[model samples]
Target: MGPYGVETLPPGVVDVPAAPAACRAALVERDRFEWRPADGGDPAALTEEFLLGHGLAVDDLTRPAGHDPAGPCGAALYVSAAAGAAMAGAPSGAANPVATLPEVAVVVYGHARPPRPPRRTEPGRWWVGPWRDSWTPGEHADAVQAVRAAIGRGDVYQVNVVGHAAADYTGDPRPALARLAGLPGARYGGTLHGAGWAIGCASPETLVEVTAGRVVTRPIKGTRPATDAGRRELLASAKERAEHIMIVDLERNDLARLARTGSVRVDELFAVRRWCDLWQAESTVSAQLADGIGLAALLRAVCPGGSVTGAPKRAALELIAAVEPVGRGAGMGALGWVGPGRLDLGLTIRTAAADGDRLHGWAGGGITWDSDPAAEVAEAAAKAAPVRALLAG
Candidate 1:
């Protein structure tokens, strides 16, 4: 169950029959209002128009903020990196596994009627095949070097490059999802089951939160093993600090477009926090929303988060497309609830998406001018280790 007591909708009884085939059962909470493109329009545009027309009240409450008290209402959305790239007018290269997923899919929950809670039952383990990387270690290191070259040429200050991995499995993925959701420091964690595809997420990074007209976004950049010495190293690393601040500044600028002049501020900078076995550095940026700022406008300015894309977002995205071999499906997107009086979404970092017998996941870090190609490749492996282990069973 989510922190707010919001549980995933049960199977076989979803009300929204108009949802696309790829996302027919991407339900958030049962007995809540849902909105999606019936005849195939822009998902972002459709959602924005729906929110504006409904005029839902927004309040400043911490997420999983429980139900609305007066009533339960919220929206859970997932937009792939490919979808975000298309929306930002960045070129996405050839189709990959993620390309088979939806461009944008959302499930809005509304009203006081309690949603059906998921049953309490342990999932069964299944056999899994050996994991394989989309790009070999040497090739991944070469890609990192290419990113450093771009930074050297001043094409971009930082670029977040990712690698994809997959392993074949038999039987259900619920047991793996359960294990992932129980991971240490999992704040926004859940599973979404479609016809033949399912996405399991145990994300810790907050992409954006809107409550009581105040908008806040926490961007995480640096990561190290959860050790006393690792914490010290993270805090003292100048390269990590530089990359963190660049993304923070980019986030502040993105929020400023819909925020009142002088209302945007950095609340916290370089705060170390624990997620699973890693210590991550995060910065909080908040702003007061301008009057009449719709959800669409806000999403347009910050759909693909800066931390995931990197500084000079457009340039970084272009380079990412040219370097990375595959696309990021649900990984690095947003997942959480958009309620009547609040909205909370998490960056889909520690996430996995399953289609047929194959389960897919991705991991990477920001590449800067000082980034070591070999170290960067190692970082990707380290980041993916835990998730791979959970799914191995």
Candidate 2:
């Protein structure tokens, strides 16, 4: 109806096929680009150009993430946005608290796929120290109050408050990290090991997905312990519902910017879903992409996703910069696959990173006018618990 080439269909991961497992991925040379957001450039657009220039369209869906170096061409992709990397304008690309990776990195595998069947890695015994949080409860609560006051002043409707935690570790982190890759209901779950850093994501939220011409974003807002009672509580909580809908509206607008006029729609709203032992509220917003829309334009339109930032994105970023301590490291941005006209990137919420001798993780939630500071703190803990437990093991 709108454009692109994709047929009109319901959006979200429900409509997405299980991502082809990158069982054995070989990092062919990554043609690197150095675009830093701190210098007033767009991280998304840089990655887009890299993706397009590589003739990076994947057609061999049957092949695993990679095949024999000389095997018939097959394609797949994986990208990581370092912490809260934003689009053109507003402030972002804060120093990564632990990892030294670029603010945004979009990688496509080249030749030299596989010379032999990849051997399954047996991670070595590891020890993780007690994690030290970047902010204390009092500090976190104060930031929540700060956001609420900003809302009171009409600066913004809502702002997501995030905090970081890190601990020293020893030995191989790959095994424990592998757990993050298969998290229940994780649309984009996997571990990517780098030179001295590795990222493990168990995120259950979709930042954006484009199939054919339709673009969809699933912004998750509410969180509760997974229980029959929690389900009832999440469904009945006026505050949770309010947070959920605000993001749904924000996403609708995000898609509208790149979509054909009058093509935006909310395909699903406030759907209760499970991620680990927690209950999360999610909604799908979609639109038919405008004609001649390229990857660069798409990333510019939606870089720091709404669910992670807040409504009136620029204003929220300003407030967030002033209040939060430390950077997001490898969390709170995008991670997942990108293809010719299709991509499935997850908002890196429940994600953790291993940088050298330390393991890092981040967690938090949206703050609104009705938020309770203590409750918000506890909720962040609950969201972070699974990742911490996995690392502790």
Candidate 3:
């Protein structure tokens, strides 16, 4: 609710009927607006009240903020399943599951109408795309240094490390996006092809979603190129299986933390999701939320995603902090929307963005005690391929 006590629509609900199936279509046909990621700042402080803005909205408007339980600041009117869980509920410092999740059904999801693309207003200067200067080229050494530091401090046994590079282009992003979306290994595909902000992603990974009070979280733990006929053989390697199992166990624990006693269970384990370029060992964990526990509260208990964060979440976050730059700028964030007591969301992986001066992209690999630093570095490079392609061309 706004300060004037106006009741806004819950997160993920667009006024258009086509929102559920084709959010971009509904948005393009309606009021044209330029939107970008907010700096997690005070909305009231912004002076330019353009006809529109773009950002996420979370599920369950009723869930109170951790620092202020009585107030309201639902951030976005729509939130992705991941952000919902990440931003929802109070900070759990390890306690009874109920204490951490005061309200169990909080669903995470959000919506963003496409925006007029960002361009250089100055005719002489061209926009090179969003710059992630915080992480620069030849930073593999930096990543390794950070990891070693974390290990030295006992912050984590292993933490996934990411690296970023830029992709610059001057033409319409759709063609580039279409090319990626049509790739051979893409199992999940979507494009928010706005005049300004274009996200063409083909991800075989499903972070989390909920419908009819049922919560589903699918974690893609392993990835290998599909062009290789021996992809299954590669996935069967002990290292890959161990990586997948650790994540599966982490996911199960995450769900079980919020699910009813004996209600949380694994729907599938070590399942394969075949995509255009990659074959993945994905796992599905699900559970029934307690009665009267709205979606907003549910998300608060989990977020930034367990798959990305690794097990022993808080420790993992600290480990990530030691390795990463301060501003993620939507890199590991979640996107999509929530509304009408149901939601659909996807991880913000395989994404590219233009923020002011530079174009940027990122990719990384999960790390375990068994991980090889060189192999992990290669994985990060492999993931960056599409992002670089989008802008390089």
Candidate 4:
């Protein structure tokens, strides 16, 4: 759901499933701001051209009375981590077989309309078969140690290593998505179904939000259970604080590109927010969009958000590609709406995708030089528990 209200597909809206050819065709035919493969040309130069070609602009703040705040609108877009990595000039490696979603999917709503409350439905039972993990606990520990070694050698500062889990299910996932949407603090929760696939996300991190002429991104990096003692520990942990600050700096730099000189600032730092049973440390970095900045330029500047991708993003991507065996399909991407004068997207953590009888979910954390390998594995399990339980019911 959007911050102001719930947004749903109106009647007659069609679902375009995850297929390379069909998805590409749908984007080409409907999307006003499509990302082409970045050639050797400068990314900044290409961004300028793309924005100009689309005539995209923020809502004029000085509009006359009675004018809507959200100006001319465009389609809703979902860009996976792989697509975002490609746009950022990084490789996403091989695709995950279990979660075979498109690299990007765009839903074009030809006109702008106010969001309404989502319809409520009765809960349905979903019995999931035994779950399997991509990596054993010991293997995940070794991967964490490898990332720490890279940090020691100055190959990278921090890399977010993730693991995948999947289970077979026997019922419609829409009911499960509905239950997830109702989860506490589920800000960017929704479900999208296509021909043979469906994706449901109840993400908490705000990757990027552009309103009027200001762009704000809240990057969450630290986590602990929501118990009083856990909150205290997270607030006082030097290691977690260091990890959170690094990503905050990275986000500030990303937003600085399109921001007016000296206009970028960290609005909030190391703030604790609750999501389900966990308390996450988040920081808000924002900036005033430079004159003539468009959606394409903004997205290009701050995509594949720093929270999911570690600091020194290119290095982190390299390490992630080297260590993780499976791809991070729908997880760790931007999932939300993009419209005229308004853009809101959440990091696709705590998200799952279903293809046929299989339900796929992923979870992981940042591996810092001081990270405990065993503890990291346990943390991933803690993060995956809520979603896993939701699916099991």
Where does candidate 4 stray beyond 4 Å?
A: 1-74, 98-100, 110-125
lDDT of 1 by residue, 1-393 (tens): 111112432333222211222232333443322222234555566665554444443322322234443443445566666656666778654355633355566655444224344345555557778888898999999989999999889999999989898888876765575467777777776765544556778888888888777899999999999999999999999999999999999999999988889999999999999987899998999998887776666667787888989889999989998998787876877766665556677888988877766888989999999998888888888888888888775
* Candidate lDDT values, in order: 0.72, 0.70, 0.48, 0.71
After superposition, candidate 2 runs with Cα above 4 Å error: 1-19, 22-41, 57-86, 110-115
CA error at residue 357 for candidate 1, angstroms? 1.4
Q: Which candidate comes out best when scored by lDDT?
A: 1
* Per-residue lDDT of candidate 2, residues 107-206 (tens digit): 4544343423444544566788998998999999999999999999999999998999998888867567667756687767775544556677788888
The TM-score of candidate 4 is 0.82
Angstrom error of the Cα, residue 326, model 2: value is 0.9
Ranking by TM-score: 2, 1, 4, 3
lDDT tens string, model 4, 1-393?
111111332332222221122122222123333332332443334433543344333323111222222432344567777767776788775566544355665544333243333344455556789889978999999999999999999988888988888887876665565456556777777666544566788888889887767888998889999999999999999999999999999998998988889999998999999999999998889998777666556666676778877979988887888888888887898777654555688888998888777888889999899999989999999988888888676
Which residue ranges in model 1 land beyond 4 Å of their true spot? 1-41, 50-72, 98-100, 110-125
Cα displacement (Å) at residue 188, model 2: 1.3
User: Which stretches in model 3 have alpha-carbon errors above 4 Å?
Assistant: 1-19, 22-138, 141-154, 172-180, 184-188, 191-200, 227-230, 390-393
lDDT of candidate model 1 versus the reference: 0.72
Best by TM-score: 2
Query: Each candidate's TM vs. the true structure?
Result: 0.85, 0.86, 0.66, 0.82
In order of lDDT, best first, we have 1, 4, 2, 3
lDDT of 4 at 227: 98
Better of 1 and 3 by TM-score: 1
